[model samples]
Structure formats: C-alpha cells, structure tokens
Target: MLARTLGALLCAGLLVGAAQARDYRYSDAHLHYVDFFQETEGMPALLEAMDKAGIEQSMISGIPVAKKWHEDEPKRPRYYAGDDADAYWYSATDSYVAAAVEKLPPEQRKRFHPFLSGINPVDKNAVAHIERMLELHPGLWQGIGEVFTRHDDLTALTSGDTPRANNEAMTRIYHLAAERDLPVLLHSNITSKRERNPLYLAEIEEPLRNHPHTRFIWAHAGSSMEIHRHQEKMDFLLPTLTRLLEDYPNLYVDLSWSVLQPYLLDDKGTPRKAWLALVERFPERFMLGSDVVGRFSSLGEQFQGFAPFLDALPEDIAHKVARDNFLAVLPKPR
Candidate 1:
C-alpha cells in the first residue's frame, strides 16, 4: 500500500512538471544574429537555444554598426555603451548573417528569415549596398532592417550623420523595399528622453504615408529601452499607436522587450486593459520579438514574460501575435 501511494505521487509530480513546461510556440520577429561588437555565439549554439526555447521560426539580422574598441581603453567593453567609444556602420555584418544561414542544413535554413541591416541609413549611397546584397544573396534575404534611425544614446554614440526615417536616403530605401515586396523593420524611436510628447512623429509618419505599398514593422512601436528607462512611461504612446494603426494599413508593431514593461504588463506583471483593447481592436497588426542580440539563452524568458498579456488576449490573436503575425509580414517567397 505504501509503495503504491509513493508511485502515484511520483507520477503526479511528473505530470505537473510537464504541464508547467513552456509549450506556447513562438516566431521571434526581432533578433540580432550579432552583437554590437559584430560577434555571435555561432549557429549551433543559436539553434540549440531556439530548440530549447520552442522558437520554431525567427527573423535574424546583424547589427548595423560595430562598436569601436578604443585604443585608450584598458579592457574590452561588453556592450556598445560600455564606454565613450564610438560605433560605425559595418556593411560586412550582413555578410556574416548571410554566411551563417547559408551553411545551415536545408531544414535548419528554412527556419530563419534573414534581413539586411548593415548599411548606414544616413548615406544616400546606402541603397547601392542594399542592391549589391540582394544581387549577391539572391533569395536568401527575406526582409530589410532593424534600421537604426533616431535611436537614443546609440545615435549619439554612432559616428555618422543622424538617420531620420523620412530622410532622402530612407525614402529611396522605402521605394526599393516596395519594389522587392520586402517588409522593413524600422527602429525609429517615437521620442527621446527629457521630452514628454511624441516629438519625432513626423519622421516615421511621412514614410508611412509615402510608402503605403511597403510593410513597415515599427520596432517596439517606436519605444526603446533608453526611452523607457528615462521616462518610465509614455502616456501618449497607446493613443498614438491606435491612431497610426487606424490610419496606416501598411504599418505593424514589434512588441519586443522595450514595450513589455509598463505598457503591455504593468509593474505587477498584469496585462493592461487599455493595451489589451488596442491589440484586440487590431489583432493582425501586432507581433512578438525577443530582440536578443547574439545570445539566445534568455529567449524563453524574454518571450514567456508576455504570458500574462498573451493569456488575456483572445486565443486566436495570441497565436497570431506569438507566431503568425510575423510570418504574415514577410515578403512572399520567389
């Protein structure tokens, strides 16, 4: 009798453990294959991480700029903002992404959607780089960007003319994206620190108006970690996004780490009703992303953190945001 009871308890524990495991599927809409230093943990490690995290598909790209290791510094910096060292546009980063994906087995290759992101957006000649990459890679690249425009301190730290979403260079890029039927992931922050309003609204709005044919995944829905760290919350963000989604059919939002705190989930990690309503109103327009750079260990946690928000959403919408929405935005394969 004692042995039978112990066996039953052991089986119950196993059942509970299996039930608690992460079974929710995910398609990571925003992941960097390399860090700011232009380094990666290799493809094998990445694949392992993805398998562990239950990421069936991922949108992978390289960081547009490489942080410079200043000669004066005694030790190497772990991140871009580690010291006063400047970062510069490194087009070769794209090649790294291309090479990494190409070497994978056919089954593994299909799981990754590569995006071109190493060109400096401020340069008018940037489009040439895009053209060259497309020609070189053929159908390997499915999208463009995580394009750095008006990023907070990174803009100040990068060495180049500040990129604007509506700038002439980006205008040309937008036209090309439309021609290629490629969706563009744009990281044009809605506001900088110290300003309370959506100060840079026109920058992104102009392109959305002009390039209706091209799909634009607005990274973080125009928020960033820096902006959140400083401002805590943007009171205007939810309403602004609502208006934009209502206005622009081509626009989509990447709900990565930046928007998770204070917006989607409150301080207590509960889903906000206002955000839930906004997502329910435009269920097709929002997607999930890990936004993990070069490392994938935290992929599960980054995505699972949204469980509360996803649970609050309708089951169909939750699945869409977690996986299908991102796949919908990618250009149809040739």
Candidate 2:
C-alpha cells in the first residue's frame, strides 16, 4: 500500500513536469518598468506577475522620459497618428524639451534633436544601476526590452517645427541600441496623415528603404490612439494593422492591449475575433505588448493587467507572442 501511494504521487509529478514542458515560450513583448511602477514596485514585482501568468520572460521597456509624457494634443508626439495626425501636438512641455539639447556639445546643438515628447538626462548613476542590475542578476533580461518613448514625449518631438528631429532622436536611441545590441521596443501608432507618427514612419522608411536589416516591433498593433477610445477602437485599429505589416518587414507588430483582450470582454463586447484574425494574418510577424500605464493614479489598475490577457490566449499563439518570437530578436539573453 505504501509503495502504491508513492508510485501514484511520482506519476502525478511526472505528468505535471511534462505538461509544463509542453508549454510554448511564454513572453510579453511590451511591459512598463518606470517612474510610477519602478520606484515603488520595481522589476521583481513584474517578474512575480510573470511567474503566475507562466510568462517565462518579457521585453520590459522602462519609460524613456521620466515626467514628460505627451500630455497635450497638437504638440503631441508625431509618432502617434489617428485623429490628431493633422493636429500640432507636443508630447511634453516646452521647458522639458530643452533637456536633450543639453546632451550635445555647444557646437553640435545647432541641429534639431529628435524625441517624441522629451528626453532623459543620461544618468551616470542610472547607467551604473542598469549595469549593476545586469551584473548582479545575470540573465535578468532574458527577455527585457527597451522602454522607448513615453507617449507624451513622442507627441512633442514628432510635432516639432523642424523636419527630422524626431527621426534624429530615434537614430540616437537606435545607435545606442545597436551599440548594446539591445532590441529596445519603442511604441508607435499610425493613424494620422501628419504629425510625429507620420514623421516616425518617414524616419524609418527613408533609412531602411534598402538596408532591410533594421527591424522594429510595433506595439499595440499601431493603435496607441485607441487606449482611451471605447466604441471606435476597432474602427481605428484594423485598417492600420493591415497597412503597417504590408509595408515593413524589419517591422513586426505586437497585439498588446488590444480591444480583443480577454478582460475587456464582458456581456456585449466581442473584440476577440477581430484581434485573433489580425494575429492570424501576421502570426509570425507579431509579438505581444501590454503597455499598462503606470501612473500614481492608475497604478492599481495597471498592476498585473497583462496576466489575464496571457491566460486568455490559446496556448500555441500565446507562447509565440509571449516569448519565442522576442528571443529571435535579442543579441544575447540578458
């Protein structure tokens, strides 16, 4: 009787291990590790959430701009499109814009800078911290990612009076990324005919026109504008997804925070089909992004929002979106 009981337990353990092995690579391409969440909660909190969700890794992007989120319209970052495409919006405040100007030597300051909303002062301490984080917790970034621009920053820089400031800023960040070989996951939404979003499109289109080596994963299926929209989100998103994937190969899309996300589903809502269909079209060309906004006010809601979305996905596709696809892009598993 004792031997039989032990044998039964052993079999159950083996089955559980096998089931876990059968699971696909679970990754989340877009995550916010920044001011609101980072200072208080930090990356460990995010990792805990991942463990529960069975997320093996995540392309965690910290906010590029600290306080400078594109808080306004016309001056909003050009990298964002849709209704404000024609509108002149700034992603951050005017005073905040001057900070990046400080990064350049006096002589070099003549050329306009690029960034959607604002810039982060290169903190020797923070870079040291980033380095420490890597050294102390080697493989901490098995799937961590570039935080890219906060939404507000993208607005201001892209809406600049100058032509290529936003592109130039991206190039600067891209240069840094190329140096570290970290595939930073920036955010962009393409709906507007003009503004920083279109400017962002031009920034990459012109440079990568022939190179074909440049690759970027568009977060949120290029619908950052839909975050606030209730009924009209699909109206704004579907067409954009089709247009973007058709154009950029070095480009991929992540169906982050889509209207079809599971939690968003309730009684009358059924955006899942459209979301799945979009993923079906570009199964290989997409990843997952969960740009859960983390401000003091919204922190509670932002906490662990992506877990449910992960649970909601079919195992196979969810595995790809969550982990495997991102690994294909990383230079080394940090």
Candidate 3:
C-alpha cells in the first residue's frame, strides 16, 4: 500500500515537471511582420498574440519581394505564390515594418528586433539600397533578410532576375553586414521541392566560406512549405544539417514550422532521437520560429507546436533555444 502511494506521488511530480517544461517562454527567431498579400493583422494584434503565447522577443521583418498576379489564372491566389507568375522587390514593405515598430511603446518596442528586408538580393545597387535604409533608420533596423534565393517555384517565377546566395550583389551585402555586426537570415532553399538532392547547396556554401564573419541564419534549414507538402521526409536533412553545423561556425539553423515534421518530430509527433541529439550537440546553433506571416491568431498555436520538442531537451539547452540563443545573436545596442 505504501509503495502504491509513493508511485502515485512520483507520477504527479513527473506530470508537474512536464507542465513546467511546456511553459518555457520563447524568443521567436524568425517571423514576418508583413507579407506580399497584406494578410497581417498588424502590430497591435501581433503584440497581443505574442504576449498570450509567451513570446518574450521576436525577429520581425517584411517580405522583401512581392508576388506578381497571374491574370491568366481562373482563380486568384489567397497567397502570393499560389498561382503568381513572379516575385519582385518592393522597398515600401520595409517602411511598413519600420512604421509599425516605431509606433510601439518603448517597452513593447524593445521586444521587437527588426531586420531590413527591402533590398533586392540580385540588384547591382543592393548594397547601396541597404546603406541608404540603414542611414534612414539610424539604429532602427537590427539585421537583414529573409532574403529569397533559390526558393522553390518562386525562383522560377522571379522574372528576368536570378538571385544566388553567392552572387556578387549578395557578397557585397554580406561584407556590409559584417561591418555593421548584423546577422543575415537568408532563405536559399537547399534543393527544389521535387528534387531530394542538395542542388543549390553551393549557392549558400560559398557565402558561408567567404564571409565567415557574417552570421547566417539559414531559414527553415533550407526547407520550404512546398517541400513539406510534397515530401514525407527529407532523407538528406539530418546529415546535411550535421555537416553544415560542423563546418560553419557562423551558420545557425532556423527550425521553423516548415521543417517540424519528419525533421524534428516523427510521424507520432514525438521528437526524433537524431534531431534531439543534434540540438543537444549544438544547442546554441539551433533556434525556433513560428514563421507566421502577418497573422496573430495562430501565433500561440505555432509556438505551442514546439512544446514536445522543447520538453525533450536538456533544461539549459531548451531554455537557450527557446530564448537566449536568439538574444545572444542580436546586434549589441549602439
């Protein structure tokens, strides 16, 4: 009878401990304040959602490019790339993000770390535009990108311009980012959605090798929504990530919602042993993100989705991935 009572108490304690783990607050390393389709609920709503979701901090940026409408389509796309022909650089989006952040109370504003996303990655004048924006904002912008290069489907649609991670234009931007002490969150998909091979790996590798000083947060760990929808699993993801993390000290992985399934969690929604081991090995190098575009209603849900993965991590490492890692990477205040 005494043993049974003791076992019950132990079970209760374990449950309480699990609950505490799930309550871990997060610093969302990747999220968009605005998107091409103008689907956002705006700043006030986002703050409310962040508060509700226990997101203490976030890296906010506007989509640097806009998806063009395809007139031939029988039905308009709810999303930018649904049936859109191409994506084009639109600098005004950055102003919208800046304006929203500026309106927040100083306390609330501090939670938002804004990144400059207005410059076209392939444009010859990309560096000039970045300099101009930095001068204009005067410490308002904290980092650069969500810069799209080698994006699935979108890359093919990117009319006339072919943006590459190692392009001269991007190299110039990397140099400037190093000088300014800003991290660059680049979205260079490692491969096309249909192809399992890391075809575009060179595009990102060159930049990592060339600009060792510039911190590069590889968005979705080089995965995309299309990849998630089409492929049950990326056989190459774990090995590729292991190599990149081992190779590039400056490279960080953004394990956003897109790569959650098959990569981080198995079919049963439990954390994969390999992924947990990877995080354990390089806790500081991995960060979580909702990758929510202009929507606050789902913010809490998006954050909660990582609870299982977080619970499985060592306490200190979980805390770092949830919050500290991102804060550690942010540019020091001027």
The models' CA-based lDDT, in order, is 0.93, 0.45, 0.87
Candidate 3 lDDT, tens digit per residue, 1-334?
9999999999999999877754688999998987676456888889889999999999999887777677777776766668756667888888888899998899999999999888888887988988998998898988998888888777777766788999999999999999999999999988877777888889999999999999999999998878777775778878988998999999998989988887888889999999999999998998988888887788889878888898899989999998999888889877
Candidate 1 backbone collisions, by pair: none
In angstroms, give how far residue 75 of model 1 lies from its true place. Answer: 1.8
Off by over 4 Å in 2: 1-25, 36-38, 68-166, 172-181, 192-211, 225-231, 234-236, 258-274, 293-315, 332-334
- Best prediction by lDDT: 1
Quote model 3's TM-score. Answer: 0.93
Q: Write the per-residue lDDT of candidate 1 for residues 193-304, one digit (tens) a residue.
A: 9799999999999999999999999999999888877889999999999999999999999999989997999889999999999999999999999999998789988988
RMSD versus native structure for model 1: 3.6
Per-residue lDDT over 118-225 for candidate 2, one digit per residue giving the tens place of the 0 to 100 score: 233222232333344445434323322333333433444443343231354455544444555555454544434333323345433453343345456655544454
Clashes of each: 0, 38, 1
Collision count of model 2: 38
User: Model 3, residue 53: what's the lDDT?
Assistant: 94
State the lDDT at 109 in candidate 1.
99
